[model samples]
Target: MAFVGMDPERIRKVAEQLRQSSHQLTMVNETVQRLINQATQAWEGQDTLDFSDAWTGQHKLTLQQCSEQLEQMSTDAIEQIAQQEKTSGITPGGPGSALKPGDVIPGTTIPMDGLTPDKLNAMSPEDREKTLEAMTPAQRAAYLASLTPEQAAGLLNGMSPEQSAGVLAMMTPAARVAALSAMPTEDRRKALEEMPEAMRDEVYGAMDREVLAQTIGHDVTLAKTESTLSVEAEAVGFKIEAMGQGEMVVNADGSSTVKLHGEFGGGRTFGSDEKGASVTAGLEAEREYQFASPEDAEKFIADLKHAATSVSIDNPNPIDDVWKVLDSGHHVDRFGGYLQAEGHAELGEFGEIAGGGRIDVLATPSEDKLEASLKLHYDASANAGDFAKFSSGGEVEVKGELEHGQLSKIELKASTNGAFGAELEGKSSSGALLTTTHEVVQGSNIGQGGEVKMTLSADNPGFSQVKEALQNGDVGKATELAYKYSDVSYRQTVNTVLADDEHSVKLGAFGVDVAKAGYHFESKAEVSTLIMEKPAGSTHYYDISGGSR
Candidate 1:
């Protein structure tokens, strides 16, 4: 139950498997049910946030599934005709030791030989109904389960609609599938054919898709996505950003022909206020393309990066030499070797850090790997984190994989010094939905810190809540939700610098900087993630934002 080292995902899978096999292994299932509860309990009160995080939906599903399975794990109750719990919960018996009709049907004393098929057929429907009504629901279920597949089918098909519904209402879904499985092909078809439309559809819909597909050759194929990539995008009032790769393969006896496709959208806007005008001012799109082979996809991906390098990397600059080093064995692409940026960033949770950073990357396409280092020094102005215009500097080392058109995996090791000293590291996989982001965190937390891991999904409820808040013109509510949502799990160490290094700072109660302190101390969250949309699935884009406090 103390699943400390055990992977939660593995535990979740095992619980699922046990729930499915609970029928034949009842008591063990009960134990597993209890264990699942324990495991769920372990997740409570773990994080410090007012709103739900990424795992919110999954945790709810786990508990709901556990409860449903518990209700269905009936132990040895159906084997005996007079079980206290009832046969409604048990597996249908096999021919080896199945109970006879007389044993299962309450108060029926007729000998098996005397109650011939002919005699049963001769009985009036009213008399048959009366006989069935005499038995308890449990006994009726047992009687049905005890029959051979053929006999069970005969009984069901012979029953009136009202009787069939009555029996189905009492039996569990598992029992129904079992009973249906035992029927003869033609008889099973007839039984289902007569089922109420809704009931029939429900039963069939619950069946395994693989079986259904294989049975009827229901092959469904979506166009292949050749590649996905991340983009460095800019948006004005009217802007859009999208990148994609897809392809169709048409074959003939001779050879397959080639098809080329690509898409791009981006925008830019400068605005002073938020207003409900000019819907076309923003640009966004989902694009698809086709490629002849994976190589074609790779070429497109590589070319995009190459174009980006040419646009951003200027000639005659020291950074160009970094590009030469990057292009030693291969041409640098989007995440190419040289990156020099000069911009002032205002972190929402944390205070303002005004500075630029330089990035140098060594990419080994032969090894499908990339290694990069980045350094940035900043002069921090007064921020919510109590920084009094201190100088800060940091470095980050990244090792990652270039797969398809994206960084499939990345590992970051980083450190910071100056007003605050800190060390951080994390790993990220876009395919896994979320990642651990490493930043130049110089212990400047006006807000809290942790190795915050975020899982991204279009269906993520936390993200959805934030989106809804913003849509409803609730900026404050949206900010709070967004911060709480993806802050998954973070670890913070508040570096205490002796007051000897203290300086004066100011605070405002209502839009006016009225209060001043020497070397101010307050928490400010160095927040990001407002503009960037965390890619929901695998794409070529860098799955990380390189700059954070």
Candidate 2:
């Protein structure tokens, strides 16, 4: 029973042969069943073994020879079956036949190959544009979202400002900011400036202050220098020292002297000494003495004596002859020259100046008259204020009349070739009537087109007579009295009535109204009986009894 093991050489040879022959032997049913059982064990906290102990050695030998042999065998078997069906002319599923090129197989599907080159070439430009426009921003975003960083940049390069802003506005804040950061500086700045305030602030907040300052400072410095002043002045002058409040001390030739204050025309005065001479000027005029020797005082006295009598009287009129020649021709027989041998002229023309060499005719009386006549025709369309002007040569003329100072009837005319004229009529401060009818025509063209006539008449009704007549209830007398005092061609009627223990007077009129409408008047005997009524017809009927008498 304990027989000797086989010889070493024979045993080694037999082991090698058995390992080589392992591929030919199929696994035993029991061993196969064991592996199946182990693999099916629920994979719960245990390692799986595919071969039992009986087949371990042989399985190792076979697996060592080819690890992926089972997978290759399965693929080979499928390929062989396909080839066999094709050669036998039978479909794989139905009769084991393979599909031929361009054949449509029953119960088999094929995907549409990605867009064909021919189909893409056939698409019209309009169709492409419409397709792009029809795409929702979110859809487009998804397409862009899938791109690599490089592809996204290249795609964005073709977009316009409005297009970019719209696309970026739809992006998330973080993504938009990242995209802006990657842009060039100028592009980034333009994009940031165009963005909404909130977005711009967010992006600017993320920038470095130093970089921002440098960028903005360039523009600010450029703007500042563009408007800078570049002109230059050449001279820098000297100043003089004031000896006192008003006098200045002049220094020259190694000596000083006080000069009188001559900066202003009427010379300024400083305090005076007992003799009433200015101390500063007096000291400067006096000769100084140094107690060095008798010779020094003697020399100073000599200099003072020489200065006292050094005044010289030169020609009083160096240009006397030249001026005499000018004076002779000053009275030349011309319209504008000196009126006398002295350089003076009496301006006789309406538009000339008397004293000045240059005469301004525009500001003269004649010019004023011309302007007045033109303004009268043009500006008379509206109720404007009076126009008047003071000529340069002391002339005053009435361009128009003042409404507040209007005379009822009077016209003033200018005297011909005269300095003064007379007013036809005017009102005095005491309400007395003044009239003058002597017409003096200053202008030759007067009354050429038509007679310019004016008249003055009474404006106030005789209040004394109306008051007396109304108190007596004499309506007829009051009517006659009111008509006599009124200016317009109108007849007035007065009526008195008693109502509610109060007396009321009613005044009515026809013809020549104050305005375009006829006149009306009302009065209450007592203040208590008066009532205010609304204004009517752009005119008024006053019940003045309620007001102070």
Candidate 3:
């Protein structure tokens, strides 16, 4: 009898295959049981006892359970075929009629032939499992192919641990990766939890490298730094504070990224201690290392672990390459490879001084050297306060070269023109108030002779010594050598346009101060320093040796 909306012949074939599989499983289980029983008679130690327990507790049990389920499934499939044949002889639309196109099975909305993945997915877990169990392999594959990756993951989540393992085992590598990658981390963890150790190991080993990294997630906050700059002079004061927060994350493909966010704000006050006018400005910047290579990731993780450990005097292990991980590479991505920064200053009676700058960096490797270029542009202005008022704009270009993964040379060119000024107030020896102000009016040019350039070649004698010390984990020796032959210099010429007895006093400073005075004040300085420390509790001394001009 011909069946409607059904393939009775295919169903019979699949049932026969399942019956054969069940029989094969039964034979394998019997053989394993017999071999284990025979082995136990001759061996009677802990090792043999462990082997016996494993076979009986997990392997044998799993085999028996699977055999029973397959046998039951084959019987059900055969009965369905028989019922279809019996109903085929009845009249169409009668109680005993075969299921027609679009007709659902009793107590379910699942159609016999036109079943969609959406309908299958909508069924309860038990119903879905039963329906899939009854389908031929070709029918099952067709439906599975139509499911989205997330839907496939959902099916895995709904299955028991053994069933989930079986499903994953049956999928191709690509499909398996997609399904597991789509699953939530916790859900995937749960799926791996209840499986036997061997099966769990197989599942883990089969995962793609990138997928495994994502499944075992790692995001760590590496460091945080804050700084405050405070300048105090008679009748004038200002304070600037900055904080930077950074995080490092290992990417799926073994790359690493360090994200940084920094914020700064400050205010300047002038006049008497009780009453004064104030101007304030705030700014924020963001930076990222888009793709530091895998080696750098390992280096950072190693250094972090080293820093957190305590060492004994007799077994000291110093960390090398502490601040040198991501410096040598072309690490920035194309789209967002620029530093983004912006800020505004509120000038008391005047309007506001507002502007920002963008800095773009590009690096490329050629032969044995890596070269990097940087471009910067900034503009800020206000039509008021002498200290705040300004109409200024400028651009800077810098290039650096590295040899053997170490910095060897640098060059800079900058052009700037604008009206900018500064104000200074003080008290005279006889208690007289004194004031000095310098301003470059609109259209005037600064940084016109302000080009400052520096270079350090690997030919320097101390360079190799420093490298060797670091490689040997002698951080103290490395620091000493780095500073001994360091090529650093500074030059300053401050010609007071209008100086008096009161303004002659020094400007107590925090950072280095360089002055070249004229209509415009130009400052140029290049500096590098390294400090070494002795063992703890012993007298600490700095082995500093460098010349400055």
lDDT of candidate 1 at residue 92, scale 0 to 100: 25
RMSD of each predicted structure? 22.3, 49.2, 27.9
The worst-scoring run of ten residues by lDDT in candidate 1 lies at 215-224
**Top model number, lDDT:** 3
Candidate 1 local Cα displacement, residue 406, angstroms = 56
lDDT of 1 by residue, 1-549 (tens): 233333322433344354445433433444555675666665656452222343345654555566456433321222222232132333222221233333434567543323433454356656555555665543444444444434444455566655655545444344555556554433444455455543444345443433222211111111112223323222234434333332322211111122232334333333311211111111222222334334554555565456445543344344554444334332222223344444455555454555556555555454465545555544553442333344455544444444545534433434343443332222222222232221222232222122222332233345577768878999999766554443122223223332221222333343433322232122222222211112121111221222111
Cα-based lDDT for every prediction: 0.38, 0.29, 0.48
True lDDT of residue 241, candidate 1: 33
Candidate 2 C-alpha RMSD relative to the actual structure: 49.2
- Cα lDDT tens digits for candidate 3, 1-549: 333456654765676677668768877997888888987899989999899889889999999899778866766775565556555542222233233445554455566566655666676777767776665454454345445678788777676755765676444333455677788765665555444443343344446544544433222111112222222232235544444544454333244665545555565544432233444455554445654454674465455456546365854753433334434334432211344344555565554444445444433333365555575656555655543344555667676677678887654546454544443433332221332332232222222112222233465545677779989999999766654434222111111112111222322223211111112222221112221212111122222211110
lDDT of 2 by residue, 41-146 (tens): 7654323343334355675456544523532343343334333434555331222112223332222232112222233224453432333345444233333333
Ranking by lDDT: 3, 1, 2
Misplaced by over 4 Å in model 3 are: 1-109, 124-151, 154-178, 182-190, 217-247, 251-549
TM for candidate 1 is 0.24
Q: Find the 10 residues in a row with the least total lDDT in model 2.
A: 220-229
